[model samples]
Target: MNWIILIIAGLFETGFATCLGKAQETEGRESLYWWFGFGSCLFVSMFLMYKSISGENAIPIGTAYAVWTGIGAVGGVLAGIFIFSEPATFWRIFFVITLIASVVGLKAVSS
Candidate 1:
């Protein structure tokens, strides 16, 4: 399903974002791994985004893009807290929840 593929793309968006952070944190052979990881994830994310927006599903471009970025933003924040030990402030969690709700709302209203 297109929705499923969109969700996968969003997850890959999260992957690339987190990998980017890891890549920035160090240098040399280990950083190379993160860079490669970021590249692979970015490729898949874009590929799936294309699939979801094109062909039969034909979701509106703006809608698809918003949902994709919404997922990435929320997932990235969670990853920052859990994986990177970033502060888990109340306002941050509240906004993340709202973003998630918006993503779901878009999906529910879509054809």
Candidate 2:
């Protein structure tokens, strides 16, 4: 359950990152919506992550933080390509796969 919560929190990290990108692309008042979305995601993501790493079942901080950011980095890149039409070059895909492997490896070895 903690792991699941951690993963979900990581996904929300992706959400906030994408929202930031969206906000950057907007102009003036139009960016407010994206900003609001970013803030919402940020809060939820951080709260969930904090919960996952807190209390008795708390994950090791180093491992937890790495996995959280790894998910966010990979998810953000995928979102950039799929949602924002960013380039899907060979190197990008390769790195993404590598990141996924690393994250999964960390998860597998964690417990």
Compare the candidates by TM-score and give the number of the best one. 1
- lDDT string for model 2 (13-99, tens) is 999999999999998887999999999999999999999899878888888999999999999999999989999999999999999
lDDT of 1 by residue, 1-111 (tens): 888899899999999999999999979999999999999999999999999999986888999999999999998999999989999999999999999999999998988
Worst 10 residues of 1 by lDDT: 54-63
Query: Which 10 consecutive residues of model 2 have the lowest summed lDDT?
Result: 54-63
Candidate 1 ranges with C-alpha deviation above 4 Å:
none
Q: Score candidate 1 by TM-score against the native.
A: 0.97
Best by lDDT: 1
Q: What are the clash counts of all predictions, listed in order?
A: 0, 0
Q: Quote the positional error of residue 25 for candidate 2 in Å.
A: 1.2
Candidate 2 global TM-score: 0.94
